[model samples]
Target: MVQNLTKRASPHNVNDRKEVLSGSCIEATASEIIQESNENMTVADAVAQMFENLGVKSAYGVSGGAMASLWGALSNSDIDVLNFRHEAGAAFAATEGYFASGNPTVVFTTAGPGITNALTGLFAARGEGAKVILLSACTSAPQRGRWAIQETSTDTLPSSGIFTTGTVFNYASTVESAAQLPQIFRKLAVGMSQPGGYVAHLTIPTAVQNMLMDETQLPEQGVSCSLVTADAQVVGNVAKLLRSGTFAIWLGFGARGAASEIRQLAEKTGAAVMCSPRGKGIFPENHPQFIGVTGLGGHGSVMTYMQEQAPVRTLVLGSRLSEPTSFWNQEMVPSEGFIHVDVDANVPGVAYPHAETIGIVSDVKAFVLQLLDILEAEEISESQLKASQPSSLPKPERSPVEAGSESLIRPEILMEAIQKVIVDGTDAVVMAECGNSFTWSTNLLRFSQANRYRVSTGVGAMGHAVTGVVGAAQARDGIAVAIVGDGAMLMNNEISTAVKYQIPAIWIVLNDARYNMCHQGMKMLGMTGADAIIPETNFEMIARGMGAKGIRVTKESEITAALETAIAANGPIIIDVLIDPDRPAPSKGRNKGLASQGVKSTSEQKPKVQASFPNI
Candidate 1:
C-alpha cells in the first residue's frame, strides 16, 4: 500500500514527519506524493529493488567504505555483483552488458576517487550510445565542507562538475530524501524512453543510505520501455526518395537491429551497401550488395566509387556521420543530398555537408519497416531498380601474407583464423578494440548477425574490449571473443575479473611488442618518435597466473589450432599470438590525410595505418 510519507510513523514522535519531510533539508517537490511505505526496508534495499525492477542482471564495481552496505544488499539479490579490479573496467563491463542484454546495467562506486575512476568508462558508454546506471555514494551530511576522509565537495555531490560537460550523461542527480525516489525514477523513465545512449547518475549520502523506508513505496519498473515507431509521413518521404535514384545504402551500428528490413530495402532498390566500422555485421559483409567498410579500417572500393564512377545518393541509416566514419573528407559525401534516418533529432546533417539533406527523426527499425511497405506499394520496374547496382566494380581482395618470415604471423592471417572460430564454428560474440585491432577486424573479419560484432569507435577508447568482453560474455550463451592489441591489454585488469568468474571469454592478444599503429605511423611520416616501442610481455603467462587458461601462438599454423583449444577450454582463455611487427599497419584510407604533407608513396610502400587511440 502506498502510504503518505508526510504522516508520522509513531505516537511517541508524531511530529517526526514535519521534521523529516516539511522543508527538512530534503530535496523538495511541488506537492505531496508517495513518500512513505508500510514495510521496514533500508535505503540499500530500495535501491537494489529499483535495479531489480529495471531488469538489471548484473552490477559491477568495487566495494568501498562509503558504499559497502549497498554492495552487501545487492549480493543477496538475484543480480550478480562482480567486484572488478578497477572502477573503470567495471563500468566498461556494464556498458557491454547494455549492448548484450538491451537493458541498462548498474555500476557502483564509492565517493571521491572511486567516482573519478569511473569517468572514462562513463564517457565511453555515452559516446557509444549505451544505456547504463551509475550509482555512487557521497560523504555523510555532517562530513560535507569539513574535509572529511575521502570527501569531495557535496555542493554537486556526485561530480566535480564534469558530467554536464558536452554530452557525458543524459541525467544526473543526488538523492536527499526517501520521498524523492519516485521522482528520480520518473526522470529516468523520460531519459530511457528517448532514443540514443543514456547514462543516469544517482548518488546518495552515506547517512541517507542507512535510512529506513518502505519497499512498496518504490515502483517495480523504473524505465518506460515502450516501442517507438517512425512517423508515417517521414518514412514515406524517404521511400519515395530512395526508389528512383542510383543511390547506395550506408549502414551504421544503429541499423543492426533492423537487418532484415535493411536487406529487403536493398533488394527492392538494388542498392550498393557499405558499413561503418562498428556497423560491419548488420548487412552481411560477404553479400554482393555490401561493398566495403568506411573509415580507418575501411576499403577503397566504396570511396573510389563514390569519388570517380557512381552517380550515387547515400541513404545514411542510424549514423551521426562522425569524424571517423566520414574521415572528415568532403568527397565521401554524396553529390546529391543524403536521406538521413536516426532516432536522435540532433544527429542529422552535423558531420558532412550534403547538396540536399533530408532528416527523419525515428527509430531505425521502424523507419526500415515503413520504407519496405512503401517500396512494395510503388511497384517500380526491375530494370530501373537494377540500375542502382554497382557497374562492374572490383570485388574486395585480401592479400595473402608473403613476407616469408616463419617467426611472426601476419595480422590478416590472424583475423582469418579468428573468423573461422567465431563465424564458421560457433555463434560467439566477436569484439574488436580500437587501433590495429579495429583495423584488422574491420578489414578481415566477417559478421552476419545482429549484436554479433561489437566495437567502441565513437569514443575510440583503447582497452574497451579487454574489460568490456566480461559483461558481453555473461549476457551471451556462447563465448565472447575479444581481439585486442598488446598495448590495450596492458591498460586494465579485467582479465582477473574474467578469471575470478571463470566466464567463457577468449582474449586474442596480437603481440606486436609495441604500439605498432603509432610506431608505424611515425616511420611512415618519416619522423622519429619515442616511447612508442613497448617490450613484449607474456600475456598468456599473466592469464595463467590469474587462474585462467593461456596459449601462445607463433607460427600461422598454430593460430587456428590454438583458438580451437581455447574455445574448448572450461574458463577464460588468453591466446597471445605474436604478429609480424614488420607488416604495414592496415590504415584503410586514413593515410589519405598524410598525402598533403608531401609524403608520397607507391602502392607497395604506403603505410595503410592510422592512429585512433582515444585517451583512456
Candidate 2:
C-alpha cells in the first residue's frame, strides 16, 4: 500500500544513471525506485525533518498558497512560526534575534514580491556579519516561463556570494530528494560555522511537495566542522603592536559577542572604548573607560578626544565600519597602524585605507579569547593595567529652574516617569523613532537582559520604529513601547496596524509642534528663514479613531498619571504628552550653545501657527 501511494505521487519524468545499488548496475528507472519508497514521507515531512535536524527554534514569515506546504512542515516541526505585519519586518526581527543570541535565525517568505521585500533585512544581516537563513517559496516547477501567479525565478537574487560581499564561504541550491536533504543541511551547518557568513536558498516546486522519498537510498549525515581559526603568528605580531603603543578599541554592531571581553581589554590596556550607534548598550555608559559613541548622532566629546589624544594603535573588532558609522570621513581614523578583526576577510580593508592593518578572520568571541591568552603570555602586570585606566567623567548636572509656581513638563522628567512605571518582570521591547526622541531614549533608558531596544542602524528610516514595535511585540510575546516624535507619527499610519492586531503596545508621542531638531539645526546654521514649522495634527484622536485607547496630557503633573492608566489597560494605548515644544534635549558639544539659548521665546512660538486640527 505504501509503495503504491509513493508511485502515484512520484515525479512524472526521470532520467536513469548507472548506480552502485547492491554493488551492481541494473537497468532501472529513477522515478520507479524513488516512487517505491515515497509512501512514508512527503515534501512537507522532509522539510520538517531538515529544520528539526538544524535545531531551529522558530521561523518568521507571511503565509501564502505557494508556501502552505512548507508552512505545514514548519508547523509539524519543532519550530514555531511568527506571522509579521510585513515580510521585511519579519526579517528585521530575525536580525535582532541573531544579534541578541549569536545563533543563526531563519525567515521564510512566499514567492515573488514577498521574497523581494525581505532583501533589505538580508543585506543588513550580511553587512553586520550575522548568520541568517532565508527560505523563500517559488511557483511549481511546471509554472516556469508561464507567468503563473506569484511565479519568480530564484536565480535573480544576488547570489549569497554577492550579498556577503564575496565573504561567503559556502552556498547551496535546492535539494532534489530526501537523500539529498541531509547533505544540504550539513552544508548549511558548515557555512554558518565558518568565520564569515553563509546563505542557503531552497526552492520547492508545488507539484513535488507531496512526493515521498526513497528511505533505502537515504544519504548519511555529513561531517561536523569547526570555524577556521586565525593564524597564531599573525596574532602574535598584532599582540606585539598592542604592547608597544597606546591603543583604543572601537566596538561596532558586529562586536556584540565580545562585549565583556572588550570591556576587560580596555580596562587592562588603559585604552578608551567607543561604540557605534548600533553598538550602544553593549557596555555600560557609566564605565570609567567609556568614551561614548562616535558618528553623526554621537557625542562631540568623543570626536574631540579621538582627534586630540590620537592613539597609536586601534583594535577594531567585528565591524565593517560602514560609511554612516565612519562619518563618511576616512581621515577621522588615523592611518598609522590598526588591527581589524572580523569574521569576513573582505570587510577589513575595503571601507578605509589603513597603512598597516592585520585582518584576523575568526569568530568575535573566539578571537577575543585567544588574544587574551597572548596578552597573558606577555606578562602584562595587573597593577600596570589598573594604573593605565582612564578616570571616569563626572555626570553633567541637570539645569535648575527659577522659583516660580508655573511649571512645564521637562523631557528628562517625562523619561523618568515612563521608566519608573515599566514593571521589572515585564519583558519589554523599546523602539525609538529617529530625531530627538531617540536622543532622549538612548541616553535615559537602561535595558536589562529581558529587554531589547531597536532602531534602524543604517537607513535611519522614520516609520520603522512604529512598525517595528508591532512586529517585535509579536515576536517576543511581550509588551512593546514606541517612543516617537509627532513628526514621525504623522509620516506613517502605524495606528492602523496596531488596531488590526489589537496589540497592547504603548505609543508615547512626544508632541512637539515643530520639527524641533531641524528647526534647531537651521537656527544654528543661521538659516532661520528656512521652512521648519509644521502644523501638527491631533495624534490622540487618530489613535481613538483606530480603536485604541488615547490619552492626552497637557500638564507636567498629568504625565505620570496618564502613563499609569495606559500601562494598566489591555489593548493598544497612545499617550500624547504635550511637551513644551521649545524645550531642547541635552546636546553634545557642537550643539550645546544653541540648546542653551532656550526655545525661541514663548512670544515667538512660530506665530501661533493655525491649522484645521489642534496639535497634539
Candidate number achieving the greatest lDDT relative to the actual structure? 1
Candidate 1 backbone collisions, by pair: 129-197, 587-608, 587-609
Which whole-number lDDT from 0 to 100 does residue 394 have in model 2?
A: 27
Q: Over the full model, what C-alpha lDDT does candidate 1 score relative to the true structure? A: 0.75
lDDT of 2 at 222: 35
Report how far off residue 616 is in candidate 2 (Å): 28
Task: Give the number of the best model, judged by TM-score.
Answer: 1
Candidates in order, TM-scores: namely 0.88, 0.74
Off by over 4 Å in 1: 1-38, 154-166, 214-216, 222-230, 403-405, 592-616
lDDT of the candidates, in the order given: 0.75, 0.62
Over the stretch 112-138, how does candidate 2's per-residue lDDT look in tens digits?
Answer: 888877766665555445567777676
lDDT over C-alpha atoms for residue 209 of model 2: 63
Q: Tell me the lDDT of candidate 2.
A: 0.62
